[model samples]
Every structure is written in C-alpha cells, then in structure tokens.
Target: MSQLHALAAAAGVARTWQDADGRDQVVSDDALAAVLAALGYQADDDDAASASVAALSEEMSRPPAFLSVDIDAPLALPASLAAAEAAELTMEQGERRSLPIVRGVLPPIAEPGYHRLQIGEHALVLAVAPPRCLLPADLPGVARKRLWGTAIQIPSLHERPAPYGTFADLREAVRLFAARGADAVAISPVHALLSGGTSFYPYSPSSRLFLNAMLVDTSTADAGLSDQKEQELIDWPSGLASRQRELRRAFADLTPEQRQEIDAWSERQGSALHRQAVFDALSLHLDERDWRKWPADYAHPEAPGIAGFATEQTEEIAFHLFAQWLAERSLAAVQGEAKSGGMAIGLIADLAVGIDPAGSDAWALQGTMLTGLTIGAPPDPLGPDGQNWALTGFSPQDLRQSGFAPWIATLRAALRHAGGVRIDHAFGLARLWVVPEGRLASEGAYLSYPFADMLRIIALESHRAGAVVIGEDLGTRPPGFVEPVTDKGILGMRVLWFERNGNGFAPAEDFPAQAIAMTGTHDTATVAGWWTGRDIGWNRRLARGNWHNEETQRMADRSALWSAIGSGTPQPSADTPAPVVEAAIVQMGRTPSVLAIIPLEDLLGLEEQPNLPGTIDEHPNWRRRLSGPLADLLAEPATARRLAALIEARRA
Candidate 1:
C-alpha cells in the first residue's frame, strides 16, 4: 500500500490526504478536489467531496463532548508553609505534583484524609493518611462491598428451538438461589443479538444498551392466550418464534386505551425510543453482514434515508424499550427476593471490555472508536498464540477529548440495575494491547491511557449509584496495577487456580483482604474439570503439533505446582471426584478476602466450563444449560450442606 493509504488505514479513515512527511493531514476543500482529480473525478463536480472533507476536518479538530472534565485551581501555599513543607513536596512528570498537606484547594483536611485535587485542567490526588496505612475513609468512595455471583448465559436458558423460558421459571430460579444462600447471579450479556439465526454469540450484539427481546417472558403480559403446558425446554429459535407470535397476538388484543398508554410511555422515554429505533433499522438493513458493507449513502449517520428508516421502525423500537423496562423490573424483583431471603448482595453484573466492532455502540459512536484495531491479550501461559477478542476499543485521545463519555455511559448503564459491576479485563483501564488491522496478535503494542482520570470517573459514578466495583486483575498483570485501584476502594479479583507463590495454591492466610475469591472464572475449567485433568487434556489435544506452546511451557516451568499437596502422579484424569476439589476451594474461602464466589457448575461437580478461550465454533461455548432445575440442584443433600457450611464459616 502507498504511505498515504497506510496512514489512512491506521487512522481508520477511508479517504484522506497526507503531508510531505507522509502523515495523514486534514485535507482542505481545494486539496480534496485535487485528490479527487487524481482519482478520476472531475474538479468542477467536487462540491460534495469538498463539503465532506470540511466536515471530517471539523470532527478531527473537535473531540467528543463527554470526555471533558473541569479541575479547580491549585491552592497556593503560603511562603512559610511552602518552606516548612519543601521536603515533602515532590514534582512528577509533566506538570503534576504530589504534596504533603492537611488539605489542598478541594476541601479542608478532615482527620488526615486523602483528597482528590484538581488544579485548572490538571487532575491529581493526595494521599494524606498516617505514615504507612490507608483507610477506607481516606478513599474517594465508600469501602467496596463483597460480590458473590454465578455466571449464566441468557440464551442457554432456552431448551432447544424456543428462545427462552417463562418469567415463572426465572422467578423460581431466584427463589431457589435465595434458598441456597446465594447472593447474586452474574449473567451473560443480554444485549440484543441479530435475530434470524444470524449469529448465536451473545457477546457480538446488535445493540449494547437495549435488552434482548428473546429473553422477555411473554406470560407476564397476558397469561390465558399462551399455552403454558407445551413449554417444555428452551429452544432458542422456536422460543423466539413463539414469543413473537404471542406478542403480536397480545398487541392485537390490547384495547385502544392500552395502546395509548404504551405510546405515552414511549414519548416519555424519548432517547431510549430513538436508540431502539436505530437498532431495529440497522438490524433490518445489515441482515448478517457488518454495517460497513451497506450502500455508500447509508454509511453516514446524516444520510437522507436514515430518518425515515428510524420512523418506520418506531413500534418495533418501542417494543425493545418495553423489553428492557421489563428486564429491569424482573432483576429488581430478584434482588428484593434475595434480600428478603437473607442474601447480603444480589446480582453482581459483568461488564465486558468493548462492544463488537459492528455493534450499535460502535456504530453510534463511530467517530470516537479505534475502528481498525482489535483488542487482545499479549502472549500468556494460558494461550500461547495469544487472543484477539475481535472487539474494537475507544481511542485514548478520543476518549479524553470526549470527556470519557462512552466509558461513563456504559458504566452508568451497567450500574443502573446492578448491585456491583465486575470489570472484565480491568487492566485495560491503565493500558491496552492494540493490534492494527490485518496484523498478527504478536505485532500488537501497548498504548497508555489516563487511568487515574478514568478511575476518578468510575469512583464518582459508582459512588453516586451506590454500587461497588470489582477489578478482574487476573493473568499477567502490569507493574503497580493493584495498589492504586485498591487504594481507590475498588476490590481486586482473586482466582484460586492461579494463586500461588513458589508452591501450590497460595496459603489461605496470604490472600488479600479486599478481594473477591473464586475457584475459577467463565474462561477457565470448573474445579472438578481442573482436578480431573480435563482442562489440560483438552488443551493438549487442541495444541496438537504446537503441544509445547507457551502455555505448556509455562506449565512445565511450574513443575513445583501441585507437588506440595502430594499429587506426584503426572497424568491425572476426570475420575478424581468432586469432594477433593471442593475442599481446596473451601480452604480458599477461609482467607481474609471480603468475598467468596463459587461457580454453580463447580458447586454441582460439573466437569464442563461455560466458555473456552481460543475456540468459538469448535466448542459448546455459552450453550451449556444447567442439567437440572435450580430447585433440584440446590436440594442435593451433600451439595447443600457443603455450600451452606462454607457460607457459615465465611460469615463468621
């Protein structure tokens, strides 16, 4: 490719001019006309192209509005105080400074508390605690609450051809969870996926903010018209078809007065209605392909036909809004039920790093997104080939210029109906590995971001929402990742499988005090699967000739692993029963971490994982449904007592 093309591609631009230095430069109207001439377009007909170039230039200069924040002027210390505290004040990179003070300009120091100081456009904070310790009161928000949750895929709730089960089934699940002393249920993304069998993956959603209509329980609307007896199992496609049919019938049966009420409600939620409308239109147009393949005129948000399309899909859009409202109501009901039944926290939600590049958030906020690049992990022991999530992240510069609006918007949405939020790939807040278009994952490089500013935004939002934040700081973490975020009252994540210090699973006493301890995550094998050697066996088979890949190499490097506990046998199998693995995890619960979350699969002695990292279609990812009803699973004598004992011990 030409240098200009390379630069344009890197910047996620389709057409642009370049400076003499080969840098992609903002093209002037006249310069755009010259480029068009070179591309065979007549100069006399360049008015449209010239206007487009001018608009693009304007957008490049003015960043998104949401990323902006105001910082107050720094307090000027008196001459005497400056002289007295000269040794305590330290100058840092670029205009930032750390000083020892009772309190700066933001507020008066009340009992040696840390204060976040903002001076003009610069934002920094001071740690004003006692000599060596940090207290929760010194942080920006309330002390982080413990989060206990289980991961569930909304789509997996379906039996076969049906989309999802009845609301009654969901209610029963909540009731069963309460009986089992479970606090929260962490579910997969319920974002609307493309319908018509386009893509089954829930993560690659058509819209992030909207709820998936497939999950809606139509029985809650009008009971008698739907056949309650025939609903056997979840058949996603069939279930969706049945729900749609029932929804249409219910709409027909609605009186004119009822229709008016719905319309009035839609009018009140104007923005939500508009967003849903956009999603409906886009879903209809794209079918299965990405939005970029759409006709040229339709590509731009200001295209002539876009408004009409939005109008046409209004009712369908309203239906989507109604679905979200119902989901919120259902979730609240679950939380209330859990609380009344004696659970401490209810419904800790997981927030994925980024939306699918072809999804709604990316489409709506196109200008701010880093479109051509994909977010992925650096080479790690788990996946020697590394991982490219195929998701697009926001540009750091665009995020700052936009006042970090997209991040805030997403957090606010997740926190809206959640008790706590688990930030997947939380390390990305500090820096992300960005692989440019068509590049191998190894070619990716790290890009730094203003994490402190981002954390400040998160703290402010979470504090206001009365929700806790958990950072999933697993895998090869960067230097000093935990200390600052933990200091800010965000809890760290601890997985037993990876916890070790020159020996098998780190001693229970060594676990951190402010963390959520669990045996495994959605990406890893269940406790039973791990002990039985199923995870390693599967990895070995998949790796084939690359069997000695980096992951295996790491495992070889950690030969001391599992040795102290007396498992000298090299090749273990799934024949190892549940009780043994359960004991190991229960031991972890005795640690000082504020929270302990045991996956239901592990709790039930299941050998399968919810998801496998590298493979998508090859494995049954997000398809595993609970083998039995929640009530039945909770009633198993041994399972119930063991779990209850763990909860009791932890509570003590």
Candidate 2:
C-alpha cells in the first residue's frame, strides 16, 4: 500500500469498495487525501502521511472507557488496574464486592448490565451483556407467534389529538390501534430537529437524546391559534415558531411550585440539559439558526461565558427546558397509555443514524464528534450520484476515548419512552461512509466502527429496558454481520419489496422469523402508490440523469410483485391498484417475521410517501397527512376490511 493508503487504513477507511452493481470501485488518491483531511488528518505529502499514521495508531492503541464481555466471559484489564492492592466491583444493581484479579484477567461475570470495576483511581465500566437480546415474543400480551403494528408519522396524524395530531393525538390513535389488537405502534423518529428549516423530516434530527417539542399538542379550550386545516403538509419553520409560542404561554403561566420543579428537573438533567438550554438561548439571543455562526464565546458549550449566560438569561433557558419537559411528559403519557391498554410493546421509536453538524448535539458533544466529515453513502443503484445525508456522527476514535457514553445515552433516550427501537441505517454499526465537508457523496470511503462493542451496548440497554431491538439492515451489510446480529437477538428488517427470490420477491411464508416485516418504510412509496406506479412518476419528476429511465422496468417490477404476492390480479396498470393493495398488505402480514409494521400511508392508501431519499424540497417529504381525521380514516369501510384481512393473515 502507498503511504496515503496506509494512513487511510490506519484511520479505518476502506481503500477499495464495490458499488451496488457488483462492480469493483477504488477510492482515488485525490478522494483519499480529501477524506483524510476531513478526518482532521493532513496527508498532502509522504511526511504528513507517516505522521498521521503514527498519531492515529497511538490513539487506536489507547485503552477504552469500557469493555463489553459476554456473560461468563473473562474480562482482561490493564496491569495498572489489575495490580492494584484494593479493587471493587459494582454491579448494575447497587451490589458491590471486592475483586481478586489474577494476571490482569478478572473472573467471569455471571449477570448482564453495567458493572463498575475500580482499582483505586484506575476504574472502568465493564458492560456485561446477555449472549443475545430479547425477542419480540418475550414481551407480554403477544400471544400470537407473529406481532403486528402500524407505523405512523405521529405529527401528520389527525383527530387523534382533536386538532392536529400531536403526541396527545398519537396516544388516542394508539388506544384505537390497541383496541384493534395491534401490539406495537412504530413511530417515526421524534428526535429533536433543527427548528428553523423543514425539520418535519424525522431522519435528520438535531439530537438523538431529546424529542421534538414542536410536535407536542398545543390546542386549548380557548382559541390560542386557529386550527391549521390548510393542507396535509406542514411548513416546519413556521410550525416550530408557532408551537414554541404556545410553549411560551404555558411556561409564562407556570406556578411557583411548577417553576421550582422545572428548575429541579433542569438540575437533574445536569450539564447536558443545561448545555442544550444554553445553546437554545444563545441561538435565540443571537437570532441565528446555525450555532457555527454564533459569536465565538457562545459557540462552545463548555466556554466559561455559557454558564454565565444561562444565569443572566434565565427565562430563555427555562423556556427550552420547559419545552423538553413537555415533550417528555407527553411521551411518557403515551407509553403509559400503551401499557395500560394491554399492548405487548406500546411504542417502537425510530433512532436516526446521526445528528446535524450545526445543531445542539454537535455543540454539546463536540469532543465525541468528528469536526470536518459528514456521513454519506457511496453511489449505488438507489441513487446513481450517491447520498450525502449531511449529518454529523460520532468519531469512532472519540467513541472509544469517551468509553461509548454518548452511544449508551442515545440508546437509553430513545428506548426510554418506547418498548422497542428501530435503528435507521443499521449498517452504520459496522461501518460508515464518510465524505469531506465539500465533497460529493461519491467521493466518500468506508470507515469501520466497533461493531461488537456497540452491539453489546445495544443488547445491554435493550435487556435492561425489557425492549425488543430491530436493525434496519436493509442495504449492504458487512459480510457475516447478520449472523451475529441475529445471535445477539436483534431482529433485522425485511421489506416486502426487498424480500426477493431470484429477481423476484420471496413468498410470505419464506420471510425470516428473526426480522421485522413491513409493507414499506418512510422512504419508500406507500402500497397504493407503489402498485399504481405513482412512485415511478415521483421518481421521474425528481430523479436526475439516468436514474429515472427504469420506469418501464419499475412497472414490470410491480407486476412481478403482484404475482409473487399471489394476488391473482391481472398485471394492474395505473388505472387500478386496489386489488394489489389488499393482497400486498395481506402478504406482508402473513410473513414469518415476528413483527409486521404497516405504514399509516399504506393503511390509508395515500399516494405520496413521507420521504423520498434523494429529493429534498422537490418532493413534499414528511409533510403528507393521512386522509381526514384518524377516527374517520380508520372507520372507512375499505380500511376496516383491510385490517380484518391483515389480522386474519397474522392469526393464520
């Protein structure tokens, strides 16, 4: 390997990668240099390459904050901790005991969870995880072999909340679904998003640790603001402002005791909460959306001035905290309702792959995040030019240095209010494709992550939460990755469109048991839209270059899919999709997967998808609302029959 290639390898970048079409693709020297530069490495010359490699190697060799050990597996420690005269072991529960380390290797741990090992000042968290994660069947009330649920973009849901479906509205819908024998309600990502942009898209959250407060139901007995009955789509920038105004009103009316409790809660959240509150206040005070453009003193979370500002502008800080509290309260209420309604798994939350580089999470967690690189995917058949999500993710190096605390916290937050979690872009666990700040997605290369350790953390958290885990491992995963994923008890996702057999889709009976079956995800077209070739129209209108030329083939794919589902409907054209919709859904429900999640759009026969991967503004992604209100929509004669057929399929 060349010096640059060595540096790339040292930094965990794949030198040569294969594209989606199975063609071998190599990262050019120029691309390698750019990616290296983005990772904060300088490889302009041979000397620079050697220095970068040495530095990266040194960092990689350093000890991590925690080591994951399977149950009954021995944990080896550095000599310093092992040689200490006095060492203590603190289990996940409050139990503590002395340790007798033999030759830097501790005895096998019998239980799973976080165990603190301390040898004087040399201490570390020993994450003892289960051999695998809990399965969906492990949850209560799931008497049937297969579990099924509806996926909802909760904010876009109507009536369930009275006005617009906020978190409150969603709870109502959940109750209705629970009554209909649904086990779970898999919702879109509720992670906090950038307030000023089209933040309606759930995938591009600002912080995985928090919920999007704007989507909280703000209706009152008295008219504060008129109902937004204009269109199904939302104007996110304006919507956030409107919601915040209502939150302000709620905050202004806070009683003395309420204010005290809020203060205590803020204190309990500690630095992370305070830092976020401070960031919000600074952003509002500066009237700037991007934190990067803020004054130098206000940009860094740990700067001395931030603490003082939080104290000076106490109301602004409190406002943000109150909003977070509202979000948490609303979410908790929904979960409580789900549990009370006798559902096995109440809510299944979606966790986004990364956060925005110019958002709160980035400012607060600057130490654990890479500075110059953005996560993206290489050019594949899905998008010929590739995909740059423009999202900032954890630096694998920083994750180790920080002992993976950020990841643990993120997982806990998502699982806190839900019975299960869906990790978007699940392949990111093993590796991620990273591009330089200014480069196209095609210019990126793959960087390996700490897969086993991260998965262990996930398993540990899921076990503790008593929640099932699902990975959206739809695309190309690392070779031999799925076995361990299944072994760890995490279910992988299987979409109706992708569960293929020799250039066609597999029969429903052939779907894997260790997976979550779904009609389509938020990114894909709804069943009606897909069967009717509406997706082809959207793709043709928005897709650039040769990507849209396959409309004829896509139409053929629809026909093949209908046949594979055994719908018995003649090759349906754009004129008729009702029969295919009924059969397609029934086929998905009959899959062997423990969990079957049908998107609300598919359930209602909506034509537009919540998101289209490549097109942002060109498509009304994440803004489409279900037809009519929740009650009216679900009460439709057609919808009732569809639900009946789906339940029959699952029970069959």
Candidate 1 residue lDDT tens string, 525-622: 78777665567667787763354463555455234334423235453333754555556556655777777777777777778887887887666776
Q: State, as a TM-score between 0 and 1, how close model 2 is to the true structure.
A: 0.94
Q: Report the Cα lDDT for residue 505, model 2.
A: 82
Using all chains and alpha carbons, the TM-scores for the candidates as numbered come to: 0.73, 0.94
Question: Per-residue lDDT of 1-652 in model 2, one digit per residue for the tens?
Answer: 7789999888888889877767788998888998888777889999999889888877666555677889998877764355655568898798998867778787888988888877776677888888888887777656556878899888687673232458988898899998898889999899987654445667777788888887776454324334655456665666566666677788888899999998898788878877777777787788786888877778687776887897899888888888888889899999998888877898999989999888899988988997888898888777678888889899887898788999999999999999999998888998899988787888888888889899999988998899999898988776668888889988888898878888588898898888888899888888888766777777667655453556667767876787787567567666676777778889988888888888887777777888887787898777776657788888998888888889999988
Against the true structure, candidate 1 reaches a TM-score of 0.73
- Name the 10 consecutive residues with the lowest summed lDDT in model 2: 218-227
Candidate maximizing TM-score: 2
Cα deviation in Å at residue 263, candidate 2? 2.3
lDDT scores for all predictions?
0.58, 0.81
